[model samples]
Target chain A: MDLLYQIFVDPFVQMGTAPDLLVQTLWEGLVSGVLYALIALGFVLIFKASGVFNFAQGIMVVFAALTLVGLYEKGVPAFLALALTIVVMLGLAVLVERLMLRPLVNQPDIVLFMATFGLTYVLIGLGEIIFGGDPKVMIADQLYLPRGAIDVNMLGGFVSLQKIDIAAAIIASLMVAGLAVVFQKTRIGRALRAVADSHKAALSVGISLEQIWVVVWFAAGIVALATGIMWGARSNVSFALEIVSLKALPVLILGGLTSIPGAIVGGIIIGVGEKLGEFYWGPLLGSGIESWLAYVIALIFLLFRPQGLFGERIIERI
Target chain B: MFYREAGQYKTSYAADQAIFPVLQDRLGLIAILIVAFVVIPLTGNEFLLQAVMIPFLVFTLATIGLNLLTGYTGLLSLGTGAFMGVGAYACYKLATIFPQVNLLVWVVASGFFAAGVGVLFGLPSLRIKGFYLAVATLAAQFFLSWCFIRIPWLYNYNISASIEVPTRTLFGIPVTGPTAAPVTRYLVVLSIVVVMTWLASNLVHGRIGRMWMAVRDMDIAAELIGIKLYRTKLLAFAVSSFYCGVAGAMLAFLWLGAAESESFNINQSFLVLFMVIIGGLGSLTGSFFGALFIWGLPIVLRNAPGAFGLSITAATVEHITFMVVGALIVFFLIVEPNGLARLWQIGKQKLRVWPFPY
Candidate 1:
């Protein structure tokens, strides 16, 4: 008992003097949580408007990031390169609406979902071929994010906060707030809600399905681009980010596909939970628990609250 | 016609209930079996049996498995690859622990492990439906895949985290691992696929299959008709997973002789899903036909450029393959949403009334 206490409990007791490592992990987790929320935002945008679970949203994050970095390397200025990338995402949105969604307007949800999976491969191959299958720097310094950390004293311990994390949190919050206003207060938001309510009725009311699709897709594109940038800054920007982007699947499950607020709350819950669990309790399981902890949490969450935190309760009547 | 079924009718209930009641179908099946069992072994080279035939057979089994759960039961799953991984790991553990057990016994029993996990994953289906259910199953995919990577004891803590297939044999014939003869391995895989396909077919044509279809078409209607949706759906998951488990074990043991988590990623799940969709939803023939086209097309794409006068790089071929396959999926959905099997049935119907207007 004395040996165990000195070996395990001593770290927490010593934390009163120095907690930089603990705070750093939490900071890292927050930045990643922001990126995850960004990817989940893209998924929620498409699902809310189209009722299609866009599995390709992860690839879209990679595609947009790769496009931005790939073009910047080709001599486009960083900001101009970012703009060009947005244009490319918009083009992708337009192309998808015209070529894929329009043709299968009333197809089964599963069919549409599968089509997005096909879209995923299309983007994967095309993005690889065009951008080259290599990880690149996200030009964090050029964007003036920062490279240092801030230390604050808490509970007789000093906690370190990275500038990149502060930037990510601020930027993500602004984007989420902006998106919330657009979804709630704008004319386009009303149209989107109407379309979401009933595709046939919205079409009957002269709301162009094509136009709404283009708008929502473009919105998803922006979300993807922002996600790519923030996530790129954390790790090197690369195609390997696809796996991390896929983490958003469990996040979406926790958040619910149809609720924007659910995404934010779910993102934080998973983010903080995974981070804390990995730091404190991961050693109990030999570490690497962070990798699948969110999923475990979501699985248990599904058992009790399958509707997600803010999602509409699905009730199927005979 | 020589293929006609005349003078071959069954007079007894037992005979009529045979797996292949039609004489021509039975004969055709026997001829196929003979070719696979005899001629291929006698004439074919090692490469054909190992690379193409073995993997194709295993994936065909998995496609059949997915077809049962997703196509017939209308329960969407994105965890097919993970389920297959469960089977492979389970088989590996079993074979290691039971050194004296026959290879075939271990393979068959490995499926029970996958089925057990599949049923646990399938539990959410009783309460969820549609897109929600797909999400739920994806949890199964990640959770199981996580188990393989994290649970060191499950994989015996290989430093590189990849399981190396151990050499094992049956009847003095090397059937798996590096030393295995290609022909012996092919026969082993072929035997499993043949018997399992028969089992799958029998199940699909029986009362259980009808109940699954009823649940798929309309769960409320199925319940109203006195079918217990919960028990039936779980059974579909278990049976489907058993087939996938055996397929996964075959893939690891017979085909690759080694595999990493990469082999069973979500991409693999998507490939099988596409096969089932392109093949057909509610048809056993669709599973076989879909597996052949989806799995075989890539090989043909990789090689066809070489046969032609033009030289195409492998990268370009991969790119072109994606574009072509993607277009075909959309085309299939647009032209005949019921898939390739429906198209085949239509062709058969057309052949019956050919050369004259009704």
Candidate 2:
């Protein structure tokens, strides 16, 4: 009975007593969820267009951040460095499409997936060599990202919110809205949807698979850049961020791999769930349940809905 | 010409179904075994035995473990490191509790513990497939790893939170612990690896392996053929984790001597998976090739600059090694998506038809 009370009753009581802390935890989760959603958006963009689950998405986030910070450290202005990073990402997309994707056309999805693992290694090596191993500041001040915190007094206490987190939430929503428009309205969008449906049919209709791959990969790279800046603002820009980006995987599974909106909703759900689990129940489990809690949540959800909340139902003819 | 098999004839069903049907292959196996058992151990220095060969053989076992599931069973798992940790920790606890039992018994038996954990995590496999399943396995990896750190009981309440292997003897010969000679440890690990590999070969070529392959090729079709999908997949997970568990136990007992949880992290899982895919999925022999390439290349690259009289920082060499390994993975995949096993097959084919285009 004591164990049951500890498991179920105590955490809720604690939350009720410290509602301010609860609000703070929720805010933190929202900020992290927005970041996770951004990373998952990059993954969804590439997976939908090419049917390739890009395992390097996490590393790409780190690499993009490192490049921007490295350039800024070398005395390039922030905006110019951002432009140069975008150009570099575009060049990377072209190179990948030509060198990797072209040769690997029609291979099994797993094979392509493994190829991305290779891409991750190469990017890690290159990034480390060029930028060095030391962590760098994200140059958020020069970029004019907001700093400090807003303290809200409510429920007999205070909740402090970081202005940067608010900006991140707003930016993420705008980007999603913009992406929705582009995906729904543009010619390239139709071409991407077509390629996503059937490669042969897309080709039959004169859609260039190679071009679409480049565009989508480039677009994912941009998303990765924005994610890097936001995440790096929160912490130091380093290879360690690569592991954190893997948090996006739970979000991807929860949201449905191919659904943009699913990524957003999944990200928030995992984010809030992770924070709540860590805050209320972590001590009972000896702490540090946050790492796997998201994955466990996704796994349980998968037992009931294998296709995910937004995923098309898998129809196995064979 | 000497490799020709035209005159060889099998008079019995057992002879016909032997692992190496070709006379040349049989001879090759014998030669390799002789070198492994006699020649290399006799001449190899301490570094070669301990650093290069022992870890190579250990990783080969782990790769074979993962190959059984991902390659043969068609389930892509990312939780191999956690499964391996279960084995190592289980062996540690069992050995401490029963000091009189042969450590070797506990080592092999530890695989059952890992197998249990693997099956528990693998329950979701029946509902999910592909990347979704892979993510599900990540839950196993992270949760188990967290448990390793958080549960002090698993480490026997050690202040350092590491498993220290105590000296254990077989036939009164020291085979483990800090006091054990490198050659003794090597021999122990090699023997276990060779026996496990042989068993794996037989298993892969038999009925259970075929069920795994059928499922891997197409689960729905496999299920239609009256094969129980859940049972077959869980069996694969259990068997795969069993091999990994034994490998993990040996990795700690015979190789590292003392190991922290850091030794069996996600990177270890990725390293074994790399070996499996780069070596060739679904081929036991390819596991060896994969282990050799992935493990040996770094050692070679690290030394190449020194041998060439070029002075470079150790960190730079490490970075270059990563770049080279990454590039080679891409190159090999582009050249032969089937992997190094296919290359070996192609080479054998060309050798069989030497001096002829066809």
Candidate 3:
């Protein structure tokens, strides 16, 4: 009976009694969720524009951040370093499209996916060699990202919120809104959607697959930069940030691989869900359930809807 | 012309269906086996025996295990490291409980535990496929890794939270544990890997393997043709986990002699996946080639700079190796999508038709 109470009832009762902790956990989850959403958003952009899964997105985040920090430490001004990083990412996109994608066109999905793994390896190697493999400060102060936390009294208790977290949430929303406008309204967006639907058909109608690929990859790169800045501000910018990319896997699948909004919603859901589970029921499980908790949640969701919440319904024909 | 298999005749069905129908191929296998069993040991290089050959064979087995699922059965798995961990931990638990039994038996027995866990995780495969399924498998990876750390019983309540192999003997020869001779450990690992690899070859070439291939090529179509999709996929999971389990057991007992959860983390899974892909998906021989390339190349590159009298730091060498490997992966994929095994086949083909363009 005591075991049952501990497993089922105790955590809820604790949440009710300490509502402030619940709110704080929720806020933390939302902030992390926004970050996860940003990463997943990068994935969705490339996956939508091209069928490739783009495993390099995580490494791209680390690479972009490293390039920025590495430049700053080398006496380059912050804004100039940022511009140079964007240019480098553009160069990377063009190179990838020409060298990797152009050669592997019409190949199986797994082939393209594995090629991205290759891209990931190259980026990691190059990033380490150029940046010297050390964690660096994100230069948040130089970039004017907010610091410190705000304490808000709610429901007769105080909830402390990181000012940087608020900035991250706002920046993520703006980026998403901006991406949505671009995807919906731009001529390139229409071409991208056409190419996404059918590569050959889009090409038949005079849409250049190469151009679209470069554009999509560049867009994904920009998202990675923004994600790096936010996440690196929270923690140190290093190769360890690559692990957070794996965290985005659950979010990407949960949100549906092709849906931008799904990425955001899925990221938030997984982010909040993981934090809540770890906080409320962690003691019963001996803590550290956060690692697999998101995957389990995604797995459960996948069981019911293999296509994901926002994914198009899968149709099979013989 | 010298390498050609042109005048071989098989008078019987059994002869026709022999694994090495060509006499030269059979001779090649025998020669390779002789080199592995007799030649390397005589050289008496402890580093080669312990570090290079043992781990190579261990990963080769793991790659074969993963190949059975991802390469043959068409289900991409990312949780191989965790499955291997299950085997390692299960073997540890079983060994501590029954010290009287021969350690090899426990090594094989540990596979059953891994298979059970694999099947449990694999249940989702019926509903999910592709990257979604791969992500689902990560649940097993992270969850099992957590269990390895959080559950003290897995390590027998060791303060270090790592499984330490207890010395075990086979016929009065110590085959495992810290005190075991490297040569003895190598021989035992080789024997296991060779036997299991032979079994894998037979399994892949037989009716069951065809069923697996059929499922891999098209599950819906395989279902229409009377192959049970769920059972076959689960069997692939079970068998794949079995190979990985044995590999993990050998890893702890023979190669590392001690291991923590970190040894079987996501990176291990990715490393094996790279081997399988770069070696050639769905090729048994490719597993070996992939293992040797992925495992051996870095070691070779790291030493080559030193040998060449270049003043490079170890970290710089590592970074260069990563770049080289990454570039090679892309290069291989671009040049021949089928991986190194395809290159070997092409080489043989070219050799057969030397001096003739066609």
lDDT of 1 at A35: 71
**What is the number of backbone collisions in each predicted candidate, taken in the order shown?**
0, 0, 0
Off by over 4 Å in 3: none
Sort by lDDT, best first.
Answer: 3, 2, 1
Q: For candidate 1, state the interface root-mean-square deviation in angstroms to 1 decimal.
A: 2.1
lDDT of 3 by residue, A35-91 (tens): 999999999999998999999999999999999999898999999999999999999
lDDT of 1 by residue, B1-358 (tens): 3444557878899898886666767787789889989999899887788767887898899999999999999999989999899889989988888877898898889999999999999998887777667767877887677678878777778998978878787887777778988888888899899999989998988999999999999999899989999999999999999999999988999899887776787778988999899888878888888888888887887788888867877777787777667766776776776778999878755554564433
lDDT of each residue in A111-176, candidate 2, tens digit only: 999999999999999998999999888999999999999998898999999999999999999999
Model 2 residue runs over 4 Å out of place are none
Which tens-of-lDDT digit does each residue in B200-297 have in candidate 3? 99999999999999999989999999999999999999999999999999899889999999999999999999999999999999999999999999
Better of 1 and 2 by lDDT: 2
Give the range where candidate 3 chain A is weakest over 10 consecutive residues by summed lDDT.
Answer: A309-318
Query: Which pairs, if any, clash in model 2?
Result: none
Every model's TM-score on chain B: 0.94, 0.98, 0.98
The fnat of each candidate, in order, is: 0.26, 0.89, 0.82
